[model samples]
Target chain A: MTVPRYTRLIQSLPASVPFVGPEEQERTRGAPFAARLGANENVFGPSPKAIAAMQAETLEIWKYGDPTSFDLRNALAAHMRVQPQNILVGEGIDGLLGYLVRLLISQGDAVVTSDGAYPTFNYHVTGFGGIIHKVPYNGDHEDPAALFAKAKEVEAKLVYLANPDNPMGTWHAGTVIAQALNELPEDCLLLLDEAYVEFAPEGTAAQVDVEDPRIIRMRTFSKAYGMAGARIGYAVGAEGLIRNFDKIRNHFGMNRMAQTGALAALNDQDWLAQTQAKVSQARDRISRIAGDNGLTILPSATNFVAVDCGADGDFARKVLAALVARGIFVRMPFVAPQDRCIRISCGRPEDLDLLAEALPLALAEARK
Target chain B: MTVPRYTRLIQSLPASVPFVGPEEQERTRGAPFAARLGANENVFGPSPKAIAAMQAETLEIWKYGDPTSFDLRNALAAHMRVQPQNILVGEGIDGLLGYLVRLLISQGDAVVTSDGAYPTFNYHVTGFGGIIHKVPYNGDHEDPAALFAKAKEVEAKLVYLANPDNPMGTWHAGTVIAQALNELPEDCLLLLDEAYVEFAPEGTAAQVDVEDPRIIRMRTFSKAYGMAGARIGYAVGAEGLIRNFDKIRNHFGMNRMAQTGALAALNDQDWLAQTQAKVSQARDRISRIAGDNGLTILPSATNFVAVDCGADGDFARKVLAALVARGIFVRMPFVAPQDRCIRISCGRPEDLDLLAEALPLALAEARK
Candidate 1:
């Protein structure tokens, strides 16, 4: 029997997932995780108002969402002080990344990212047949200067930098990123992923002009807004660049509940402030728990902390596996040096108590 | 100020939306549509249980949806009597079509479709730089033989056919479609979009082997399941073809609420029967309305009916515009012959009552 033909690029790609979800892990383990702190999900949950909004929209699920996402875009524009044309909302930052890569990366084009940064971005670049250039992070933070220099050297079509970077939970100030933008190659676009910006300190957002065609900043409701399950995010850039997303995006991809929930979340700044404060307290508690266990925690600007196991990558893997075996879901960096740490998202006190109870046993098991 | 570089194909394409949603028209006119029958959405809404499931999921929106969609996929596999590996759930059939086109259609690859059947499919094909070969619809129904012949003639990589088709709301028997498969080129994959199959008459779904590598059938929760705004759909095909979607699909793209809602929807077969009956009644009412206006209505096996205006395409266009002006939302075909009719969706009696009240005036206005 003849198999259906796939494109040459598709033929070359192995069927794989970038990250196995906690739910998948739970299924394999035959039980739910005791502390669901993996995947960097905000365990504090979405604002009550956002949940109510989504619930209200549940009855109106028959009508397809507005393909243009008009109300949400207008709300975002007003909130961000940019024109609606400057924004493009999609399924999530992951979905928007796919569209951006599809628009700019033809086969054989070069793209750049940190060696162990967001794998989903790398997946998109490679999926579209773009050759990827990897740069190493400086200490725990993404070195923007190194990324820009490499982009110029490689003649890269796109360069990805995530502020308050994942896995390490490190961040650079907004002004630093704005200054680094000057070194960006004129022909290369900077894909500044700010998925975690909502949890970072003041001035964490890049100060680049909204009309700057050289950069597109992506923000998500998946993090601090606590709507990761809703799968909603938006990209902000020059109108020319933003409008190009229309050429390839699934125009009706946004769920109706997501659109409504995000708008309500955006409107509730008080809830955002309260959530941030709670995350901050949880981060302190996690740091304390790490210190108590004789482990060092990386200073985190986001909701997650990378606790140094004070050993090599192999030891860190054992610790991560042991934690999972103990029904605590925590992930770690995939590359070396960074892989010496285990990444843990901040959770409520009760959840953290479970983590605190599991960590010592996990460490002892790894040592044995 | 240097502009970001878009790929050559992207540069060649104009930024356009596949469909102008009813919401956009409402924004342009500054008034809500009195009868929203334009987008073929099931106005009866989703099952109450589906709504409850979605609402329950709202509070847990912090966690990302299961990337594998294991629960939903297993549920669908059981419902369809197919293996879990045979099903691939996606954002919607629209998103899946984009992925399918991307998998098979490299630049300049030839694809076949009816001239005016499903513009979104055409959009995806062209977005990936596929060359489209269009065959005219045979009478009101999509001509499967003509499409297969065109596919062979052009050495097309993909051939798209929508059964119980959109806009024209016409369908052929499953046995006829199954027989037409013999004429399809061996190397060309048949993309059978069964988006409306649930509303079609019994024996409408083609009896194809699930292991048939030559075809993939797509179904959606947006139709008889009444969850269009939820944005969930699935494709069933040979295991090999189904596995290829994992190589390119957004692994975490499914919304948690959507996954829960669709599972609830699938479990509620009683709701499905009631919805089908409601749609059949609405179709009869619409047919009677067409008769009252001295118009001929096409025989419909789907939720909508195409009413022939007894004039040319231009007259039909005027009638559609008049209906829109009278606060009734309806659509027509884009190509000739079929464009001589306006498509009206199955709606609640109250919604159709508004349509009934406006049809005579719309006809009078079009004549003027």
Candidate 2:
């Protein structure tokens, strides 16, 4: 007749996930969306060689994946020009964030991030009973100086900043971010999420030395390498910090096919370059579509663009609802001011054509 | 110049991984082993349909996995004769264990397990700063009464019991376990890990109602389903307990190919039946080989056998070391009494032949 007793921290936490996935939406709607442009996924997909490699490796799925992620780490180290010990290959950046939060954040500990930054990071922070101190976005961009100041004020153990930010699709140059790191509080580690760095302009990656213990950069193959479903991401940090992940990480967690696919994806720089070109072309096409509807598009350095709906958040919500009703799946920012824009991921010509056709009708429906 | 301030718990934990993966060993030896029998992986591999489904899903790698795991959960729910809310599908049993520990065991919280049982579970408990109270095995079998008594004595929040257990390859009947539940301490949850239940005798699965709040049973696709590398496992429990996992789990941590592959694997029970039969045959063959080598084997209900080397812990270690050196990747128990037997995973016919060739030579080298 007795039940499990959860910890105080677990008991106090709300049982809400960070975001509801598109599949859940499709299931509830009893229909699938025509254009899957809401999740900021690279619709151009992974390299042909990566697909073949994963397919080939599928036969070897009987064995557990290498806990060390030796080959992938070495290849990544070679590419990043750092030692293998400085990189930690994990299930994904999301999983890595969870571990990092667990490592540093105890109950009532402070963490700092932008108010409208990655909700997943906030989810992990609050999940561990850490108090999240948020700074509002300065315009459409995350103000690093404000976030750093908040981190210092709150005595936060960690502060998060995403370069080529999500939802708004705006970015700071590598040099701009590199200089901003100086303002970061002493003992407060900066989580520089570069999940969309692959699609950003040249010199967008911060020029920080691998020996700098103040920052950990998270990069994912999901964005530009186009293996979002594979769930492979890495974090580059100081040797000691990276090695500390071995203490609590699910050592044998990576999928075997994913390990091989990501390795192949990393090697095929030509495909990544081609995907970049497609993303650029698609971004331009998306802007044209938005402009035709008399909406201005944000300057995006990521694979997605934010198109202003030329109204308040309430009006934008109606437009978003209409678009979803029309089977054009797109999302907007959770925080206000930015929520007036609808964020759309780069898709193939046909998928965007669906979006292009639906927007005008969706706007008309919203107006009515 | 200040480094990150780690939590007291994180500062205390050593940065040591639980088990060194076989791939790491292969990389170290500069050659792959002839037989990989250490990790309890199914040498027979997953269903042909699972492989094909994963291959098909690989093309959709640009999309993130469904955070809800809706299809997989619904399928598992129907198969297990339970409602969807009563189940929680996770990365694997390992990943689920980590979450379960976090839910119940806070710093200095009491947890109980057999000393020689699963190290990964112990690793998670300790990593979370939970104080583990060890119960010794009664001869070869884990004594349920002792574990229950210990939980009460220590005011333990959780007690772990893996039926048809790893390393020892032993089990009690379902009725035995069901009857033992009455002795479980009040407020203590029994983690009945059924990772090896598919190969066990009839009635080995406990006859507990899904509504029972005292126990949560974990099952995996890694064993009889032969999809270890794909990382899919589920936990069946009371609805309240099951739903609580949503508070902290990585919503999109699962690989997309794994989700589809697992669904296809669950539907094809024929492949599972074939795998169970093959595992049984391989176990018998392993026993025969041990007998021919003038050694005895513990009766096993798992996809592996514990062959008694007719020696002490030191001698068994030598034999295991020799076997690995001889290119046969067999492992042994970490604790005494169980360490007298070397555990060998069920391998293919050709792999067994390699094992047969290597055993005598390894023993000879060990005797030296």
Q: DockQ for each candidate?
A: 0.81, 0.82
Please give the distance, in angstroms, between residue B185's alpha carbon in candidate 1 and its true position after superposition: 0.9
For candidate 2, write residues A267-305 as lDDT tens digits.
999999999999999999999999999999999999999
Candidate 1 lDDT over residue span A32-146, tens digit each: 9999888889988888999999999998899999998999999999989999999999999999999999999989999999999999999999999999999999998899999
Worst 10 residues of 1 chain A by lDDT: A1-10
CA deviation > 4 Å runs, candidate 2: none
**B154-218 per-residue lDDT for model 2 (tens digits):** 99999999998888999999999998989998789999999999999999999999888889999
Docking class of 1: high
| Interface RMSD of each candidate, angstroms, one decimal | 1.4, 1.3
Model 2 sits at an interface RMSD, in angstroms, of 1.3
Binned by DockQ into CAPRI classes (incorrect, acceptable, medium, high), candidate 2 is: high
TM-score of chain B for predicted candidate 2: 0.99
TM-score of chain B of 1: 0.99
